[model samples]
Target: MGVGGAGCSAAFAIASSQGFQVTGCDIEKTSPYLDKRLKKFVSIGHDPAHLKNSEVIAYSPAVTSFDSDNEELVMARKRGLEVLPWDLFVAKELLKNKFVIAVAGTHGKSTVTAMVGVLLEKAGIDPTCLVGAIVVDWGCNYRVGESKYFVIEADEYSEKFLNFTPNIAAITNIEFDHPEYFRDFDHLKETFKKFADKLQEDSVLIVGSDVNLKNNNGKTNKVSGPADLNLKMVGGFNQKNAAIAAAVAQELGIEKDSIKKTLESFKGVARRFEFIGEEKGVLVFDDYAHHPTAISETLRAVREKFPDKKILVVFQPHLFTRTKVLFDDFVRSFTEAPVDKIILVDIFAAREKDEAAVSSLDLTRAIVGGKAKYIPSLEGAATYLVKEVSVGDVVITMGAGDIYRLPTRLLEKLEGKG
Candidate 1:
């Protein structure tokens, strides 16, 4: 099977561990996420020409479903081989379980999905799990187990979550995104409403408590949680995510106390505002907030949590299309909680060509009333942080890229570890 993104990582782990004779492929293989599993891949370029022996083709959400000629897809179909999409595979697995907790929403899918899995395992649930991001406890994305419960990230990228009939569904805030796939916020909201329609009669749907369901100047109604879900997290948004997850866990017969304890102990997921070690006197952190909405939540959280400290951000623009599409939104997302310093790194263009004339300059130019500057590479960005950063300044390197390593490397450099 062929796949990409966090979904692909799961397929790789499963196929590799089960001795299913899987040969994965990708274009650039240097990033921490890509390079960590570099030993198990073989590919000259982005196309699936190397995996010619693949019996059936597997695709990720990043892979366009409408495109029939997506190298691996076209080749497999031409040879009369089956093409099973990742979402379909994940959905089928969830259907077999009596207690499937599906985490669905535009944002916080990875964090909430992994949090549920962690809580279940901690509570001795031994539930089979499928998360988009790699959890520290599992050290892998997908797990095959002997349990009745299953939890997976129910993504709305292509309304893929609709295929899964979850026993306990959780929606951790719905926002407008993936403009390349959807037309407008209305179209996206309608898709989410349709997903809600798929739920069984009062089977329990856990939505964010303070989530503005309808976007920009629209109907921003909030979905209240159960009495047991009355707990707080880092930010208002994260607290909502924790509440939604707790509600789902409670619906599955998990005790209210355990839910509270588990959520309180949930530190957070990697790249979702992860805390990297500090260097000298500056505190280092990282987050996987490529979209403007995510950026808003993350920056807001840091601002609220560390109000006295100076907030410094090392931002990397992911995907040329995304950066180009919401260029101004990226700037305005940080409006509410404006930081003291900003270091803009080169755009982490994944899959898409630089046709939209997108660059780091767009984000830098849009950052209003902030000390925003452009740096080309991770090394340069880290160097600038070292030279310019002062005591009590919180440094956050954010994006869906290998920017997290910068903080670690900087710390290592300071401690003579590198």
Candidate 2:
């Protein structure tokens, strides 16, 4: 079984909550970022022997990165083991038994899922949660409770969420970002519509008012106003996330007082504007904002939180195909953000090989306002920031790549440890 973020979360849910013997592996088993729990059960590389006594083999998006010729999958098929994608496993094992509340969207699925989990738990419902991000409250990506409620971050990548049966579904906001999977905007929109249509006659759909879906069939309860709670996080967009979360909790008969208290006290998940530490009066925050809209919203949120602080952004593009396809949007994303400087690092090729057509320097050049620079290495970017960053600056390492580790290096360099 694969053990990426989503996959690891699912594995943890099954092992910790359901009390199953869980073993997992990734292509890079020795990776520094590999979950420590997974490292205990996972082997260094995939082998046919690993699948010898397996009952079911669950795979993550990592397996699909190879497209079709995965050897482990071939061995599983040859051995006649029950194979399922991780999301399908969630559907078969967990969602089928619980009152499923699935959150689906491009940008805010992880955050919204975590918010719902925190709110429900704080409300004493004790729901089982399978979120994409590491919930700081639980110190893991999943929480296994005895209640019949199961909250999951329903991902739309490859239409994985369509398999999950959700009695209550929430779409935070819809946009086209997964360029490799979807053909165009229309194709992505239709996929979302299909997801919305999956709601049963008695089910409810919670959506943001900004989402322009014409065929929701009046089952949706739109979140159009500010939440009644005092949000501790930054950004007006978080208010939108809170609004949708409140709507979901309200549908479940959770009291407004409890919802308000939980939403206000809920600390965010890891890597969604996670503040690492301050070095010499400079604050470093890490965020998973690879897409254009996410980048823009994150920057705006930072600006709103610290009005006088000069913000420096060090962004690593996630995939090569995403960079090549959304080149214009990427350019506009940085230009639109209210940051003082932009440091563009090399693209982190998640699954695609570099075709030499597009580079980070090209993105830096395409950006207007002359506020960006191309730093080839993460250390180089940290070194440059060490000299240039001031006392009242906020440096955010933005991307869903290995760049999350860069903030620590920057902090160390600022402390003269490098």
Point to the candidate with the largest lDDT.
2
The digit string of per-residue lDDT tens for model 1 on 298-380 reads 78888888988998898888877778778888878754546888888898765556675878977787777757888889898
Report lDDT (CA) for all predictions.
Answer: 0.70, 0.83
What is the C-alpha lDDT profile of model 2 across 1-418, one tens digit per residue?
5575554545544554586677777666644334566568777566677886788887877666865667888889888888888888778866666898999888888889999999899888999888888887877788888899989898888898888767899998888878888898889888988988876557888888877653244367878875756877777778888999999999988999888888888888888899999999899999999999989988988998888889899999988878988999999988888889999999998777888979999999999999999999999999999999878889999998889889999999999933
Q: What would the TM-scores of all predictions be?
A: 0.84, 0.95
Error of 1 at 213 (Å): 9.0
Cα TM-score of candidate 2: 0.95
In model 2, what lDDT does residue 266 have?
Answer: 89
Tell me the lDDT of candidate 1: 0.70
Worst 10 residues of 2 by lDDT: 7-16
